[model samples]
Target: MPWQHKIAYLIGKPVGISLSNGQGTSGILCDVSNGKLLVLEYLYQSQFALKQYDFHMIQDINGFPPCMSQRLY
Candidate 1:
């Protein structure tokens, strides 16, 4: 599929991914590109502290969008 169509169709789904800094969290796939994925509502730990996160994208899931539904309900 086209990149635009892939991005547009990737807005709502769950993806199993990790951060570049070695953190773990799961959320809806909000956006995508050839090099990253915009994941919403992410979670991770840093500097010995727990943190809430948003807008995280890594290099693993690069071309393929999340293979799940975005809706939580």
Candidate 2:
């Protein structure tokens, strides 16, 4: 699939991500689009050096929206 399409699918779902370059740290998909992602509570070992992963999709989790809503003041 094209990169854009792949991003589209991840927009509203929880996904597992593994950074390809940096310490191979894995993060949960907090937000995603055709070009970027927001990982939440992410942590990796102390050896990886890359900043971003190569985009790997693990099994999708149930419950909770991929993106959370914020209250306006």
Most lDDT-accurate candidate? 1
Model 1, span 1-73: residue lDDT tens: 3233444555676555555577656666766544455666544553232233333433233234445867788
Tell me how far the alpha carbon of residue 2 in candidate 2 is from the true structure, in angstroms, after superposition: 4.0
Clashing pairs in 1: none
Clashes of each: 0, 6
Candidate 2 residue lDDT tens string, 1-73: 4443554555445454434343323334456544455555434565433232224542222223456577677
Cα-lDDT of candidate 1:
0.49
RMSD of each: 9.0, 9.4
For model 1, what is the alpha-carbon lDDT of residue 21? 75
